[model samples]
Structure formats: C-alpha cells, structure tokens
Target chain A: MSGVKKPVERRLRGEAVPALDVARIRADFPILDQQVYGKPLVYLDNAATTQKPRAVIDAVTRYYEHDNSNVHRGVHALSQRATEEYEGVREKVRAFLNARSVRELVFVRGATEAINLVAATFGRMRVREGGEILLTEMEHHSNIVPWQLLAEQTGAVLKVVPITDSGELVMEEFERLLGPRTRLVAVAHLSNALGTINPVRRIIGLAHAQGVPVLLDGAQAAPHIRVDVQDLDCDFYAFSGHKLYGPTGIGVLYGKEKWLEDMPPYQGGGEMIRQVSFKRSTYSDIPAKFEAGTPNIAGAIGLGAAIDYVQAIGLDAIAAHEHSVLEYALAAAEEVPGMRVVGCARAKASILSFVLERIHPHDIGTILDRQGLAVRVGHHCAMPVMEHYCLPATARASFAVYNTREEVDVLMAGIRKVREVFGQ
Target chain B: MNDLRDLYQEVIFDHNRNPRNCYCMKGANRTAEGFNPLCGDRLTLYLKVEDGKIAEASFQGSGCAISTASASLMTEALKGKSLEEAERLFQAFHGRITRDTGGAAPVDLGKLEVLSGVSEFPTRVKCATLAWHTLNAALEDKGEPVTSE
Candidate 1:
C-alpha cells in the first residue's frame, strides 16, 4: 500500500518542481519552466493571479488567428464567428454560476471594474439619501472604496459589519446592522488575505428578508470552491478570470435579469446603443448595455476554456485536494515555534496567512524568496481587515489545484529559518 | 537546503537584530511619518537642524529588515552632515537603488552599498528607500511642509 501511494504522496506535496511526470496536467502550462536567481521557481502566490494553461492560451490564440473581428454588428463570417464564441462564453458562465439567464452575465475588465459598475449604476439609481450600504470588515479595498466613492457622490450612509478575532464574520452583528434603511449589502465570498470562507448564503438570505440586494465578491471564492449563484440566492456575483487560470483583462458579473433591467446603463458607447441618431438615442439590451466598448473577445473565450479545464478536473476532487493541502499546511505551520497563523477559522479555503512572533511579514517574505518560495506579504488591499485583527500585515500562502502537501513542508522549513534569523 | 547566508548576509541579519541609533530625538525641529502601505511599514523620522547642519537625527517605528536597517544606517549617516550634503547623499542613494545610469555613477553610499542587492528584487526597492524618503522630508530647513514618499 505504501509503495502504491508514493506517487500520490508526491502529487499531494505540491511539488511541481519540473522533475515530476504529471504530464497531462503539466503540459497544459508552458510558462512553468526557466530560472529565477539561478534556482527553479516555486510560485505560491496563486491568489494574486493564476498561471494560464495551454488550453486557455490556445483558445486566445485560436480566436485571434481564425476569428478576429468586432462583435454584435458584423455580418461577415469572422464577425459571426466572434459573436457566437463571445456569447457562447456568457452561457458557459451562466451555467458555471447557475445563473437564471445569459442576459444576467456581463463581461468587464475584471472583478474591480465589475464592482465599480454596480456601485456606480445600481447605487446611483436605487440608493437614496440616508440609505445604508452595509459591508463587512474583511472586504477588499475594491469592495470598500467603490461604496465610499458612491456614498460621497450620493447622500447614502455607509455601515460596516464587524468580524470576530478568529477572522470569521460576526453574523449577529451583521443582522443587527441590517434594518429598513439598508439599501444594499456587499461582502466578499472569501477573504483574499485570510482564507476565511464567509457564510454568504445565510447573510444573503437575511438581507433579502429585509428587501435589500446583495453582491458577492467571488474573486477569491470562484477559483477555489464550487459556486452556485442560484443556491446562494445572491442578487449579484462578480469574479475575475485571471484568478481562475484564464487570461487577464476579462471577468464576469452575474446579476438577476430583473435587477439588471431596472438599473441604467453604466457607460454609453458603441454596440450599447439601439439606435444612434444623436437625438434621443435608445439603449441596447442588458448585458451589452453594461459592456459599452469593444469587449475582450479572446479573453472571454479563454475563460470558457478555463471553465472547461476546471470541469474536466472535477471541482469536487479539486476541493478535496486543496482541503488536504490546507490541513497539511496548518499542521506544518503549527510545528514552527513563534509562528502564529493569522486566520484560524474552521471554515476556510486553502489560504494560510501568518506572522512570526517578532519578525515582520516583509522580512519573512524576503527570506522565503531567497529559498525560491513565493508568498504574498502585505496588507493584501484589505486595510480594515488588518485593523480588525490589530495587525499591520500578514504573510499569505494561498493554494490552488496544482499545489501539493510537500510544498507546505517546504514553507514550514522556510519559516523556521526566519525564526532562527530573528532570534525568536 | 541552500545557503541562507547568501540572502540574509551576516551584515543584514546583524543590523536587523540590533539596529543602531534606533530612538526618537527630543524637541526636533522637523518630523515626518513615512509609510509603505503595501507592506504596512511605518516610520517616524525626527530631525534637528542648526546652522544648516543636522544637529540630531533619530527614528522610531516598525518595519521589515531592509527598512529598519536602512533607517538605522540613515540615522547614523545624517547625524552631523550639512543639509546640502544630506541631500546629495539622498540623490546618490536613490540613483544607486534605481540603477538608471548603468550603476557607473559614484554615489559613495559606503556600507549602504550592501543594499545594492535590493535592486535585484523589484518589489523591495520601496522598502529600502522608505527611510531615506522620510529623512529628506524632515531635513527641509525652510519650514517646508513634511511629506511622505
């Protein structure tokens, strides 16, 4: 049994260190090789952006090579091919999130632009003076800054739902913050800095009882867990493609068709106008209305390929693999003296953020990089979350499908060296 | 395991362990807070200038090894230097870190040249320069408003 499981153990060690024969999967990514500082690279910063597989890269190349043209208006063969491929991805996203209609899916630059679109358009239309926009303490700056700007532009009041010391959302406080004055609730599905997977479904249900809309920032969640917008009953869901092993410059925003129709167009430009006489121009349909200018044609197709890749691997298997990796990392980190895991919530994705007792996170990151291990060390664009925990910054190591348990052990060794250097 | 000595040279680890001149100057003429929001590095620089020369220079804050070591070296270097000399050093140090002039320019950063390795790590350039930027702000002699880098 031990001999048979040896290969499996190697895969679980997150050791894609260029010597493994994990061919079917390894062949898909071409940029994994090459040297950094004369050592093979160990990229553990997947939460920032995932590397693209050959399928995603090839999909982008194919579109440009065979079917590159403007979409929604062209009558020629290339136009028809591009439009079909672009709209086809919308359906794929709809099925991926289990959204009600293809009309609900709107493509944008990424999750940042998606949040800004809703905050500017829906916020300006529905939010009134003294209306409340409730967000959590663990929100990324993308979620917080847009609401702040919206509140300044409009007369709405912004409220925060606090988090517990363990980094979990305080549901009781969230409920208490909700009332008749609350117009909308925006919260992250999973924290980027901490791996805390929030109870968004319960939070969404509670918000709906009070007749308020909820937007889930799925940038961190969609890549790690299986997301079903219908099951969650969230009013809107936003995620970035780069985080999901797809190309950059493209992401999806899934909103209910009724809510989307009710909201006004975010930007007015070509392909979003029904009739352009320069005198009272009519607007196009929902998704196109939000997608004003030329969309990222190749990026949308690449996202479709990424969805195919995830589905082929089986999300259930991937989630299970990541769970075991997280468990291994947690246990390994515990073995290091003076190292404190920042987010220790029971319900979490595979993000392990921590700090050595006396050593700063930046020092930890620099020392680890010398060992060819990559990890993020900073506030992670979530200042309020850092403030909530009374920490300045935390070193974060996020896991993806390809990561193995062996890599977790390596990370542990690197951290032990940090402790020794700090004399803690 | 690779040699840890290469990345964390004995000099750097020594400075990080026991930083020199790590205190706040009392009754300083100018003070400014420098922050590298990316890594949550915060440092308060205090300077006292008399007769266009630095009478006292001190710092108090928390940051990473590069930043703390850089500040420690800076406080030692600027203690008695004239305002003009300090400005010249700052420019030379900045130019050395950025390596814009093919690194041939003679800034004479002295022991500070040990940090030249930092230029290889693009993300850490901000960390190494945070203290110098703050010191420049505090050393302004003409009642110029203190600013952050």
Candidate 2:
C-alpha cells in the first residue's frame, strides 16, 4: 500500500495539509487524459459512475486473455485457475467491507440487484401483510422500488421518515416511526442527490433497539466512505463496483451470517444447487446459494484490483482529499450570483448539487457539456427528494479522488457561462 | 460555442425568459398535457377551436430554454390555422427536427425552422417537440397525457 501518512503528514505537524499527489493518481486513470469539445474533460459525474484506473482495466483484460473459464465446476487447469481468481475476489471483497466472512457476501449485478435480492428473499420471509417497512425520503429509487414491490405483493405498508430542509434525516421522526409493526428499516448511507452523509450507525442502533433489521444502501457511500459492516452492525449493506472505480455488472451485498442463512435463495440456477433430482433439490450454502449461473468472473477480478488500488492510496486520504475539494467548491459557489445549493447538510461528501436562477438544469448541462465539464443534471433518480425541495431537477457535480480544485473552478466558470447564455 | 449559441439562440432565451400566452386559457375547448420523463419537462396545451380553425393557442409549463422557446413560438405560429394545416405543420416540424426527410417534399416551417438545430442534439429533440405532441393530443381529444419517453 502507498504511504498513507505521506499525503496527510502536514496535518500531524500542525501545518496545512498537502493535497494528495493527484497528478500521479490522475495518471493511473487513462480515461482522464482525453479531451471533449475541444477542451480538457473535467469529469464531475463520479456519483453516477466513476472512471476505472488502468490497473483495474488491465486486470480484467488479463483475465479475458489468459484465464477464460467458468468457475467452480471446471476440472481443467484453466477452469481451476479461473475459479481460484474468482473465489479470491470474494475474500478481497470481504476484507474491503470488513465483513465477518466471505460467505456472508453475495455477488450480484449491482447495488440495485443486491437490494432486490434482500427485498425478494428477506422481505418476503420477514414482512407480514400488516408489517411496516420504514424508509427515508432521501433513498434512491433502487432502495425504494424493491420494497414497494414487496409491499404491493404482501399488502404491507411503507412508512417514510422525512428529512430536514438541510437534507439531514429527521432522527426524532425516525425514532418515532420505529413502531411495533416496523419490520425493516432501509435507508441510504449517503444521499446521491444531496451529498448528505446519513448517520447509518445511529440508524442501525435505533432499528436494532426496535428488533428491526436495517439494510443500508451504500451505493454512494462505499466509494467515498470507509464502510465497516461489522462496526456498524447493519443487517445488510449493498454497494456497486462501478461507483468504486471498479467494473460494472458486479457488486457486493454484505448480510449477517444469520440473515443469509435464514433468507431463501434469490434465484435457482446451475451451480447454486448442491444436488438436483426429479423430486426436490437442495441449495448450496450462503454465497453460492445467492450466486446463480455463470457469474461476472472478470468483473469480480477487476473489482478486486479496484479494491487494491483504492486501498494502496488509502480511504482516509481519498476521503480527506475529496472533502477538501468539496469545501473549496462550496466556497467558490458563493461568487456566482443567483446560485442556490439544494442540499446544505452539516456533514456532506464529495457531491455538490445546486441550481442557477431560472435556468433549467438541462440547459446548464448542455452548456457545461460544450465547455467539457460533465455534470449530472436531473432528479438523480430521487424524485421524492426533488419534490420535497419543490424542484424538478438540480445540476450535480460529484468529485472523486482524481478531481482537482482547478476542475471545480472550471465548473464554476461553466456556470457563469450558463448564466451568460440564459441572460441571467 | 457556435452550436450552443445555435441551440440557445437569442430568440430562444427571450421566449424562455418571457413566454407569450403562457397561461391556462379560459373557455378552452381542447386541452392536453405533455411530459418529458427524461428531464421532467411538462406543459399543458390549451387551444380554442371555432369552425374547424384554431382561434387561440397557449401553454403553461416549466422546461429548458429550448423547450420553452419552442412552445412559445409554437403558440404564435399555430394561431388562426385550420386543423388540417396544423397537422401538416406538425408533420413538417417533426420532420425538420428529427431529420427524417425521406424524399418527402419539404414544407416551409417559417420561424419554426430555427429549431432545426435540435436535429444535431438528438437528446433535446424531445424537448423541442414536447409542445407539438401535446398539441396533437389536444386536437385528437386524447384525454390522457402525452409522454415523450
């Protein structure tokens, strides 16, 4: 691993902390070197999806070029090598999330699928017709829709905890809503649209007090925060690899050993069963029970490489660097007249969601695209949050480890150009 | 910035800032709502038809500059036109914006031709045509809201 202290050493010496060697970090991501619309590309859409480093790219390429075989059932040498690489990634993911065991982690398509798996299996088993599934207003659609489907199927009611105007969760309301009928409490660890870092540890504690299992949607958190599922004691945690600078089509769902054992298999397919017969079939244990058919072997290996890449730089360093950059951006935003930031939580991450006066987000997005600043402009799949704010959409600029203060300046300049275009 | 300028021309900015007849018309015989799910742009079209001709047209909604301008200009161009002419104009406007000129004789779109730049931005074509789609739905009396998916 890279020297973790070298990046933040100045802080220890009572001096101004030096920024991460972003030049070196930027060099590792080959996609960051490209140009768009005759200007150097400034990618601020990390919340939507992060760009992959060359290490991850090469790991996936090497897998497809050399070790190309199905996992587990292969008796050939190539198959054995592929299975070793594939299974090794499970251990890496376990360590990345600091989970109890690799068996507790199941590889799914993405965070969306991981939540669906929990909702389909655990939700189907635990929630009764009158049971309540509690959620927050800031949850992404992935976390909300699955439970809605479960509620629709079982006639269970979905109770929502509201957020404050500054995008912080109303903790008192959450405590009040954790009633006797509440079976599950699912919420986002970090708001994708608002950049609010939710107090998931407290949320888990309250839910555990009520004997309710809390499932955390870490799709936005895992990329920026240090996620220790054990420390938080969350019953379930989910995150996508793509947002963590890894490949798409692969993610991790970390459930407690007991929960994984109690929940039925999400899908029945080859390799998930121990023995098939004419009568009934028994399923394999935990991870294998959830992973059905041919998995994304290369994606898993690439995710392992991604974990290694981020670990070497250190999560603390990444978080500190992104936090400083976000702070800088927020301060710079004050210079732009008529600029209104949508979310102003006391604690936030690398995302900056804001709106310029009267100019629509789409127009801002198009103008920024011409200036080679890629920002996400929409409701960010959190329509309820938009409705709460009485806005159709807001332009979002999310930062990653590779983002620099200079790029944030360019973004601010792009907003000024948008104002010029709209005659604001 | 030429393309940006073309997409958000001064005229577009003007209409977006100060839309004409941008209100719910009273005593409207035909009304329909349009929704662009991609960007959450929505508008309601109000038309007053008399003796097979449109006597008044107006709309009220929130959308991007391109969409707002297209809607405002559409209300101006569509007034005092027969239903048949409106349909033909829809076809011509759609054809011009979508670049689907399959050897059909081109119809003069007049002021609406400024939106021809939308063809370059395939994504914004929906924004440009949302008002026209609502007009179509209003004329047909399709009570259901039209969606540009």
Candidate 3:
C-alpha cells in the first residue's frame, strides 16, 4: 500500500489540496457516507453504475412529490409543468454535447436501446445486403450485438478492427478495413474494460472521407471526459444517464439533424404520429417520431438535474481529481506481487483492470468484497476483449469524482490481503 | 475475514495446489464438459464405468480454488464406488454445500465434508458443484455440455 501512495504522491507533487475538494464532493453523494459489510464502503464500480448525488435524487423525489403528471398532451397546469421540465432536459443535453439542435437529441431507455434504435431503423432502412459494418474488438456487447443483429437481418457483413496487445486500436488496420463495401463504422469512444480512449475524432474524419457514417458508443466516455459531438462531427453518438450519476431508463442518442430527418422513425405510437387515418399515417418530427411511447418523464427530469450538478462542479475539475486517483492506484496496483494489469494503453482514463498471479478474478473479487471494496469482476459486457487477452475475466476498479487517494490505499491493502490469504 | 479463512481451508488449498486425478482418463467411456460462462470456469469430467460400476474418475479444467479443490476431492472419492454409490455420494455432497440436509452431511462424506462451508457463500455454490454437475451428465451418458446457469 505504501508503494501505491508513493507514486500518487509523486504525481500529486505535494499539493495536498486538490483543485476540487473531494471531501466536499463526497458529501453530495449521500450513499457514499455509509458502511457495507461492517466496513466503510469503498465503491470502485463506477463503470458499472455510479451512485446518484443528492441533487439528482431530490429532483426525482420532487417530481413525484409535486409535479406528478404526463407530458406534451394535457391541458392542465401539472401536465404543462411536467412537459416543460421534461423537454427542458433535451435542451440541456443539446448544450451538454454541443449538439447543433434539440431536434437531434432523442431520449430512450439507455445506450443499448439507443444503438438498437439506429440499428433497427437506420440499419434496416439503409444498410444494403453484403454491406460491411466495421467495429473494433474492444466495443461492449451492446455495440457489437446490435450490428450483428443488423448483419443477420440484412445479410450485411460485420468486419472488425483489431486492437494492439496494449488495447489501443490499430489505426492503419482500421483504415485498411474501410473500403467500398463498408457502409458505417461504429466504435466505442472509450473502452469500458481497458480504459483506452480511442482516437474517435481521427476515426470519424477517416470515415467521413470515405463518405461513410459513424456512431460513437460514448457510454464510458461521456461520464469521464469532455464530449463535443459537434466538434467531432460524428453522425451518431449514444450514452446512458445512469452511468452519469442520474437515473436509469434514460439515455440520449444524438444524431445529425439531416440524418435523423432522412432516416425513418424507429417505433410507431400515439406521440409519434402527426395524423392517422384508416388508409395511412404521417410521422410528427425527428425526436418525437423516435420517442413513441410515454417516456420516463421523471427519469428525464432527473437527468436534467444531473447535468446541472455536473456542470456546477465542472467536468475539468472532476476529471483532474479522477486522473490523480488513477495514477495513484496504478502505482499501488503495480506493487502487488505478480499482478498483471490487463490494459496499458498509452492514453487511458479512470479505469484500472488487473489480475493477481495464481488467483482467479472471481476469488479476487470475493476477497475484495469482504473488505468492502466493490469492483466489477467479469467480462464487463465486452467478452471479445477478454477473449482477445485469453482471459475469462479481469477485476476492474473504476473511479469517479468523489473518490479520494486514501480509498486507493484501502484497495491496495485489500489486494495485499488477497495475496496473504492465497499464500501466493 | 474469518469466513474467507474457513472457505479456503488448508486441505482445500492443498488440493487446489496439487489437484488429485487431474487428467483425462485413457479408458474412460463417459465424458462431459462443464462450463460456467459468467466465471469462465470450464472442465472436462471423465469417468470409467464398467458393468454399472465406477472404475475410475478424473477431471481437467481451470477455475477458482474452491472449484478446483471441489473437483479434486470429488474425483478422488468417486473412484472404486459403484454407480449407485456414486449417485448417493453426489446427493450427500451436494446437499452439504446447498445445506438442504439441515446444515449437516446425512452420511459420512470423508474429505468432501470440508466444502460444507461453501453454503454460506451463495455465489460460490455453483463453483463447488460445477464438477459434480458434469459428473451427473457423464453418468447419464448424455455426452453433452453442462452449464452452471
């Protein structure tokens, strides 16, 4: 554990007071101020789902407390208030991503559904038989399975861009794979398992040069780094709100306005129809046409509160504090005897995945759990990455804004104990 | 972490470190593969049964210590037992880990009793029984893969 702290201290350079007060930030997340397994909870499973801050929780509670009504169709005051707040989130997301317009942002269940919306609709509408859908091996199953389903339905081929042993994408290989048969290139902006931040801006530019569209699975990126969909100029981007410390059952799919207008609606229901007759029906508009049913009104409003909360703390400050934790945790984890860190990409983010010698990750996870260190120990919905590394699974520790350097020490101590019990 | 110590007993650790009957039996007539996709635990359970009686038992795979040790102990106890006896032993061993027999082994299970502490860890019950499940599949002569879903 001392080895872990030394590297972090070197990185910190004697600055005890970080730019963002993590202790003050920890207070906002009430769930953090509790105990698990008779020990103080050291939650490091942010990549799976983050704990909601008080503001996001209060926003949901306040909705049920006062503004409990449906949106977009009612004449009553409660309905109007609910409608305004719900739609207000769209504008907030629009600004958050620096998207061109609110018409481009559509809310869905999550990143999985958002990808499926594009697959089922845009994929079903435009993807030709024998066309190729190129993806990297590091993408989550949510990103991979949708395209595979699309391939099965359309007889289109699914091509993959291989990753280096260090978990970074091979740019030359990606460029070579993008040929005439390639219709779309879909890739993750940041790997959930490896923490490898792909050169998405460069990848998007390469795809655009070939007149191909691209979709960035921003599930792991949106929470940890700055995302400018406009600057990147991606045709489509998807992310979930629950991972961003908001509510579940809510996410955003930002598509270029032209693409959304050109593609057909995903689902058909009351809200999406402009008019309906026995003979024919006409769709309403881009976003409403996509979000057909009565949406999770409370979830969307709560997501709006989350965006406001993150903005107040600022993404830059949150990222800086998390980066410190990452560097410190890395130095500590490397000190574990025979410890093998899975992903060592040159540029990474708030995740650290590793395995101890002679110890299965499941045992390691169980031992860590007994010490109240919550980590995700599985394929992480990215099984190909595991297969690529010839591993069944790896233990992952992902940090967030509220995490402190001390928590990393606790994690290292717990890992050392794992070795002690195993006698390794 | 007393529970951790109890779960990873010295005998279990010894067996995991040097598993007994860890091989594919050459004259084995029955074989089955077991897989726990979630944990990436896969093993091939081989049995040599002649005239409805067990002749030999062995297994090969990779998994956590609890699972590896469980398979090691299971194969050792299963040798020289008749088919009916093997079935009865499986019931007793499984019941011990699952705590279905009022938290006590109904019969003397010998070395297999060390794994009784596994019942406390609900998530690891499948790991302890994965080899046994594969053994059941081999005895049935289904020759298909088994899953710990």
Off by over 4 Å in 1: A1-23, A420-424, B1-7, B100-105, B141-149
Q: What DockQ results for candidate 2?
A: 0.85
Candidate 3 or 1, higher DockQ: 3
lDDT over C-alpha atoms for residue A236 of model 2: 95
Tell me each candidate's TM-score: 0.92, 0.97, 0.95
List clashing residue pairs in candidate 2.
none
lDDT per residue (tens digit) for residues B1-149 in model 1: 23444335667767777888778878888788888777788888888889999888888888888888888888888889999999988888887777764445566788887777777767778888888888877765334433223
Instruction: Give one digit per residue, the lDDT tens place, for model 2 in A1-424.
Output: 1232343345434544345899999999999998898999999999999999999999999999999999999799999999999999999999989998999999999999999999999999999899999999999999899999999999999999999999999999999999999999999999999999999889899899889999999999998999999999999999999999999999999999999999999999997999999899999998899998999999999999999999888787788889778877887887799999888998899899999889899999999999999999989999999999988889999999999989999999999998987776
Q: Write the per-residue lDDT of candidate 2 for residues B9-128, one digit (tens) a residue.
A: 778878888999899999999999998866889999999999999999999999988899999999999999999999989889988888886779778888887788888888788889
Name the DockQ score for candidate 3. Answer: 0.77
lDDT of 2 at A87: 93
Residue A310 deviation, candidate 2, in Å?
0.6
> CA shift at A31, candidate 3, in angstroms?
1.2
Ranking by TM-score: 2, 3, 1
Cα lDDT tens digits, model 3, A1-424, are: 4654464455556544348877888999999987878889999999999999999999999999999898999999999999999999999999889998999999999999999999998888889899999999999999999999999999999999999999999999999999999989999998999999999999999999999999999999898888999899999999999999999999999999998998898988978999999899999888899989899999998899999988888776677678878987887777778788989997788999998888988889989999999998878999999999999889999999888889999999999999899887
Count backbone clashes in candidate 2.
0
Judge candidate 2 at residue A269 and give its lDDT. 96
Candidate with the greatest lDDT versus the true structure: 2
Q: Mind giving the per-residue lDDT tens digits that candidate 1 earns over A1-424?
A: 2443354456556643222233456567777664556655667898999888889999999999999999988899999999999999999998888898899999998999999999999999989889999999999999999999999898899999988888898899999999999999999999998889999989999999989999999999998888998899999899999999999999999999999998999998997889988568889988898989899999999999999998888665676677667877877777788889888776888799998887889888887887778899899999988888778899999888777767787788888877776666
The model with the greater lDDT, 1 or 3, is 3
